[model samples]
Target: MQFLFADCVLDEERRELTRASQAVSVGPQVFDLLLYLVQNRDRVVSKDHMIESVWGGRIVSESTLTSHINAVRKAIGDSGEEQLLVRTVPRKGFRFVADVSEAQNPERLSTDASILSLEATKPSIAVLPFQNLSGDPDQAYFADGVVEEIITALSRVRWLFVIARNSSFTYRDRDVDLKQVGRELGVGYVLEGSLRKVGDLVRITGQLIDASTGTHLWAERFEGQLENIFALQDEISASVVGAIAPQVELAEIERAKRNPTRCATAYDCYLRGLAQMHRGDEEAIGEAITFFKRTIEIDVESASAHAMAAWCYFWRKVNGWSTDLDKDESEGLRMAQRAVELGRDDAVALTRGGHALAHFTRDLDTGIALLDRAIFLNPNLASAWFLGGFLRTWHGECESAIEHFERAMRLSPVDPELYRMQGGIAMAHLFAGRIEEASVWAERSYRNLPSFLMVVALLASTRALSGRQEDARRAIEDVQRLNPSLRVSNIADWLPISRPEHIAVFADGLRKAGLAE
Candidate 1:
């Protein structure tokens, strides 16, 4: 018998596997494993069944079995990350997820792999129901509610594909292997946790795992009073989603980078762009723009890509790295507008594009409206919250701006852009006439990113306003080095302070700190 699939031919009588007419040097066990998977392509082959059939019921260590599976995949140009052909079924078994046909001279007919491919080949996750460890049956509902809320929260992430609760709950109370769950549910990551209730206090523990690799990427514990069960549910859900999103994003970026460039997809290019964007340096931002441009070329309607590309220009402008200011502004606004037009429901696109509009067009009202809509779409999105806070600060909504910044910090406490959030809080304080608070936050932000122009300016302004002459002078020196062209006279052009009084506050500090008018 002979089977042909994905340019590889498996011959049973001669016991040979050939690719592009060249024979593959597979070991006996690997050959048998491949043959068994191909023969059972109509269904998943359980690990036990595979061991019994291939290893003759002998005891085989997990590492040995994994090695054999890897060998088979390598022989056929498949990888664990890609899972293009051989797929792992979490808590289930393995399946050959490829099309196969019998050779003309074959004695047996070929069965097509029954499992269909994922509709969207993006990063996907499944959230299982949290176990109730409280020793009370009534606590199950609360645990279930937390899982449902997490699923709902994760669904709001436009870039993530989350499994529905109905499908995920099917494995309730099942002691399933994480890798098996990944294969069965066809997800890259899995979130599992437990909840415990004691008197008026509740404790929840959660862990995020790379299902394919069975690697625990993140784990944390949350404790809160259960005075209001629903409120506690909301808090835990937000915290879990906020912590897991960044980890999953980082894992996806690394996976995309691992794939060969020759086979890079639009999603892969976008992920690479995001990776570069997080570096937040001049050269890295330029490379990020290039990757985003490539993504746009491949997928012109990619709203998030357009928004990110626009924001790259905004970053360059704010950091004083743009070599062509007019070109950057024009191109940035064009992309930002297009992103808003295309992605009315995408929070990330709306957040980045709206900030660009606020910075480049000075349409603060329109920008704030877009950001508010984004928050409505995904309330847990930290970027939307922080960027909205920034616009509010420029628009003289000092108290409201501080609230938004605080909310963003709560959402993503260890965010990569923590310094930006800190800077926003400082600016709000400076505008609200809280010099001591502004100085503390600005100094903390400066320590994280010394070259951040706004933070440096804030430090100088707050120090000068608080009568710290020498410290203010040092901050002014750092500011001058970061942006040599900046002066007190042209502060309005640099920052769009809507109120004349707010501009006066910023300028007075700079003037006091020896910035020439």
Candidate 2:
């Protein structure tokens, strides 16, 4: 489709923007934003509405938006002062004032005969639940997590259509033909894998096939010790993403490659630790820490193990699970630093280390830079985006923080840690003075994970700030129930923010929400 605005034309099919028949440079995201605006030019689009449509519901900085707007203007030979084509209304939102006309491309709209025939006949692909070859049936969570992670990784590439995990996992334990599976799942590709574990050694084999032709597109064998199970998983995920979307950067692919230790025993322990870490309870956290420590004991150079151990300690400090905060903080910082030093090339390791540094050492800029590098290396890494969001929020760039959080949420759509992302959104809205919007998001966060005390606190504060006294009081009560010794003064210590005004806004909200003096 061709979108004509002023003297420029955007060819959606070619993914190119042009001015007077000459090509103009524009990033994919900027192009998308411009297209969306032009398409919806009839009315004013709110920031939230634009975020959902353009960024795929990921939160981005106001500055980032401004930069894109500037780029769009420059490409169309307009300026902020001119406001000739696109206009930003203060306190409201953006509007596209340009006269736009849509030109159709008949060839571009033509459907593949095979695809059409299949649509009348059957759907295309099915993602089978990976078989847990780990003798311990309890290790099912690890196998399940792998499939989920793969589903998430594959969904990020715009060209590939993926079946949701819920729909894909429905065929668990059922055997079916690849062609039939494809028809059932409505996808052209089928991915099947098996996980096998014997003591410390784990071997995973995966194959990708074009269901329509019943041809194998790619296949690989990943063999590693349990100590490097996480690394192996990362590698497998990256390989699958690369095979499915060849346009992905070579640097990103290399960054996604995994090099786990040759020691099978340590690898097994590490996989066990990974499973426990996903549980995210105090007992599970302790068990994960023990297993990670054991992995490190067997392999002192295991950067992943140290990074996970530090993450567990950081979690403990955040959740008030550890009595010795100073000791935990010191150990977490040291381990995170060591992990970064040893695993600078590892995206996951870098993200964990960056998060630890940001939270424990208050090194916001350094931490953000590390996470950004990690994202550059692996754009599909959800944890890196999550860490970026958290750091940006702490640094008081609420708008940008929201964008990172939204991207992370999109990357891990079915992740159980969704509450964290929702809370991030709520915080951003709270800081932006959209109290009602913050309350709505806070409520969503609470509904998703009721035990999240921080979300409960934020919900109460939002309600109070919005002048809903009764609801605020109830939320405050919920907070007190979760943390019996809660008080207002200690909030500043628990909450991470660089600006006093930000803290003041939070405090005022909480106070109005009926927080204890």
Candidate 3:
């Protein structure tokens, strides 16, 4: 059925809307709300009725409903003030006030609504309830909460379609075929996991599968002490989403790669860059930067791409791979500033751009503030927490820095950058005068990545402070091997240590460890 009103046609068959012969981009929820309003044009549908029909009776905030309503009006070229079509009936609900005529058949091709309704051609997934292996009713409740949190986090990814918890939970405790679940849920992928509790520790295992093919895409296990149940749940949610997001994107990228004739879009270029960046090698990072640059050229307002390009430069500087430090730093700073300017509310942009700005400009406060805003926007973003921890460590917030690092580590336990977070913890411990703990973490970080200059330096300092002369000497040798130019006198120039006391302590340790003054 097609509804025509005020130069706009809403095609129910295609799940599309066109205004003045031009396609109007509308979100699924917004489109559903508009259709519901038009179908009940003769009556003022109450909020309860709208929620039941449009949102499947899920609990929605007033702001969310209002925003969808506003989007519906904007799509139809109407407004709250004018109320030319959709009108708010005060305490009642909404009514489509315009004349609507329906047509049984249209000339346009009738595409499958299954593909069209799934985020307008994007891939969609449903996260099934994790089985409670402990057989305890309380554990089952906890598992449900974990799934709910995972769904909430996945919803933040703009490119993916997430089935609502209510819909996904309908398969709870039911043994169903993966392909059947896919067809029933109208999704391409499904995530199922199991939760088990042992003593004061909880273990959660999750696996992502291609529902249509019954092929496993990714799987991982997370275990942590239940010191604080709520915090643990948050951590598991972050880790699950963080791991799953990249796997899903990589799967999509591979799918796109398989289609040799498909033209590359800005998003395709961005995804390719993301895959390269995750490789974390000098040459791969350089290639990632090129891909991101191509993305920017294709879409000039690609804030995340710009931020990633700047971050690649920062990565080069950190690893001493910059052939021309001055040129790279300037270019990186420009992109970082541009990213923050264009992406005030974008969490990824703010996190990467803020960290790059902090590194290139040495403006620790601004960088910390921007990262804090990113955390506020997306608390599950592990990079924001860990990177913010770095700035906080330099800013002399020792305890707070440690908490951030721990939280980040928990959020992505298997993250390739785990070494970085380990090094951050060592730095924080060293600053707090915990030599033994610092040495332990520094050694762990050095074992993970021996070439990491900061870890080597921290190891030398902590070993020297702990009165281990021979071990400190070996670490000092490794540090000089990594960066021969680094000296006790130039500690401040090497790192952004803003606190005089922290600087004094770090330099004193390096001096005792045999670095030249």
Best by TM-score: 1
Overall lDDT per candidate, in order of appearance: 0.87, 0.73, 0.85
Q: Which stretches of model 2 miss by more than 4 angstroms?
A: 1-264
Model 1 ranges with Cα > 4 A deviation: 1-120, 260-263
Q: Each model's TM-score?
A: 0.77, 0.52, 0.68
Clashes of each: 11, 17, 0
Provide the lowest-lDDT 10-residue window in model 1: 110-119
Candidate 1 overall Cα lDDT vs. reference? 0.87
Judged by lDDT against the true structure, how good is candidate 3? Answer: 0.85
Q: By the TM-score metric, which is better: model 1 or model 3?
A: 1
Query: In terms of TM-score, how similar is model 3 to the real structure?
Result: 0.68
- lDDT tens string, model 2, 39-92? 889988888887788677765667757777777777788899999899988888
Per-residue error at 229 for model 3, in Å?
A: 9.2
- Greater lDDT among 1 and 3 belongs to 1
lDDT, candidate 3, 1-517, per-residue tens: 9999999999988787889997765656778889999999999999999999987787766876887798888889999999999999999888999999999855644223463345234578999999999867788988999999999998876567899999999999999887788877878789999999999989999999987678999899999888898889888898899787766766766765665633255666777787777766678889989998987765555678889999999988776678898999999999999789657777889999999999899999999999999888778777899999999999999999999999888766777678989999999999998889998999898888787788888988888888998989998898887777788988887778999999998888888999988
Name the 10 consecutive residues with the lowest summed lDDT in model 3: 108-117
Q: List model 1 lDDT by residue over 44-81, tens digit each.
A: 99999999998788777787689778878888989999
Q: What's the lDDT of the predicted structure labeled candidate 2? A: 0.73
